[model samples]
Target: MLILSRLRAYLRAVYCRQSFFPGPLGVFVNPFYLARSALQEAMRDSAETLNGRLLDVGCGTKPYRNLFHVSEYVGLDIDSPPARARGVADVFYAGKAFPFDPASFDAVLCNQVLEHVFNPDEFLAEIERVLKPGGKLLLTVPFAWDEHEQPWDYARYSSFGLKALLEKQGFRILNHRKLRADVSVLFQLANAYLYKLTERWPFSARLLFNATVMALFTLMGLLGARFLPDNPDLYLDHVLLAEKSA
Candidate 1:
């Protein structure tokens, strides 16, 4: 049953381009999709309940609507996106800052987008301004990883750094947890290089590579979590929650 579920998951991963592992098969197994889902799940674990006007910054394809609650949902991105982002977002800003009054939103959920911001401080300030007093801010950023989106990958956050940054911008820290980086996290990353092997072999061979690497990594993590005591570095998702004063 376990193997069957994993096989199903892998097939879904491949068909969906959701991940390098098989499902979430993005433009060559993008990491953000899986990371985003993991982040959202973490947010829920931390008592996150979205309400009021919401801003999802750098919202590429705006993937969090399923979990978002709102008086409004506004998405902002750096590029001119493929879709017009109609009624869902109410409006789509061409760049980072939302064109709205201060204290306008009750919740701001920014997942996997902070590393891309050239100025995280300015971005947080914008979030502060837009969030109503005592509103919520949920964010996710990688702590350990590679240089991705080259010209963009500006910063990563340790629990302390993320907390300090948020506090400096007037947000009080409510919950901050470092993402545990297991072997699976590393394996997912390794498949990135695996794609290059496809030039030497068939696509099925590449998928085979993906399956093998992901399986190995997943096993390592499961075993590590079970045996390794008090290891902080293994958690692969950083979940942060801060609040504006009311």
Candidate 2:
């Protein structure tokens, strides 16, 4: 029991640091590796264009902080128990509005947060208000994901739907991408479903079971991705880069 607990803690520590871009062992142990790895690739590709006084909305642990080349990075989230426990937020705000002045930031990064926003219009408006003209907004939202973050999870958006939503908020879309547009998405979902079924098992048994399942599924997913036709229309998430018109 003690050994299993220690092992779990060690793996968790590794997961915290290498979440989106997991290490080799993490490839087998992490159930969401396929989805998260694709997200990391998209973010890394988009990180270079963002610079100076950047704001990270819903910055849970500022996981990708080192990826961006910016003069200043400020983390913001709602005042909640999870946010406090993470100890990453530089500023906390009520759900309605941000605490900063208008046109305060040169760039804004809101990753995997849009689905959780109850008032997306007001949320995007706040982002636009806080960002300087011509500043970039790098946003990622889930398109085909299970409900997460509990009761806070509200919606999912298709590629076109997301584009329309951002454009409605006066953000000019620069680049839009569909992530995990491969058979890997199917395998990932299967692995996740199985993982949930074993939730009641002992920690050691569950861990072993998940690791085996993940490994097998990941291998199959990779092979399918190599051989199958890609389906961009059916993907896991959408990553977009938009600019506030100058």
Candidate 3:
């Protein structure tokens, strides 16, 4: 078991740092099972800018901690069942407002969090309030994801929509990136549905069933990529780097 775990970790390290083939099959070969290597790569690329006192909103297990060169890292999340299950974060708050004073952080990382917020305007307002002048906000939101973490999943944001919303909240967009291509999105949707369809089966059977389906869909995605032109509209998620006025 330990050997398998170590092997998985080794593969993940390779995938995040050295792998960028982006062929249809290459993207779906996520050894860590979440297909977040691209996202981790994006964060690592901005390590220099992310340095200094940082806040991780909705940080799950601080999975991207090593990617940043921050002086201080403070993770904050709501004290809910879902958050507690993750067993992470430095502080947990139950209210809508943040506990920190204004301009408290040099950088804020909010990963895949906006879609779960009930009031995005208010949520971003709090982040802006806590960020220092010229501080950067690194955020990711899904455009084509299935609803997970039920009751909390509220909305999805397109690349344009996210940019406009951030600007309205007094941020200057520095960079925006679509994280997944058409073939990847197709692969994810098919895999997700297959998993859902097998939810009621026994544990071993469900695992076997989903694995078989995923393997087939992965091949299909590769074939689709060969004939399909790249389309931004079919992107699965987006990442943004925005800044507060100095």
- Model 2: per-residue lDDT, tens digit, 140-177? 99988888879989999887787788889889999999
Candidate closest to the true structure, highest TM-score: 2
Can you write out model 3's per-residue Cα lDDT over 1-246, one digit (the tens) per residue? 999788767755654443332333343443223235456667677667786899999886777777788899999999888778878888898749988999999999998889989888899999999999999999988888789989879998877778878988899989888865757567767776776776687644644554465656666665676787778787767878899888
**For model 3, the run of ten residues with the poorest summed lDDT:** 25-34
Better of 1 and 3 by lDDT: 3
Q: How good is model 1 by TM-score?
A: 0.75
Q: Ten residues in a row with the worst lDDT in model 1?
A: 20-29
Cα distance off (Å), candidate 1, residue 169: 1.0
Q: TM-score of each candidate?
A: 0.75, 0.94, 0.81
Which of the two, 1 or 3, has more TM-score?
3
Off by over 4 Å in 1: 1-14, 17-37, 44-48, 81-90, 94-96, 181-203, 233-235
Pairs of residues clashing in candidate 2: none
lDDT of 1 by residue, 1-246 (tens): 999788877765564545312232332333233344455557557434677778787666665565565677877655444535333344557556778788888888887788777788888899899888999988878776667767768887677778788889999887777654544455445543444545376545555654556445544544664565544765455777888877
Query: For each candidate, C-alpha RMSD in Å?
Result: 6.1, 1.7, 4.8
Poorest lDDT segment (10 consecutive residues) of candidate 2? 14-23
The candidates, ranked best first by lDDT, are 2, 3, 1
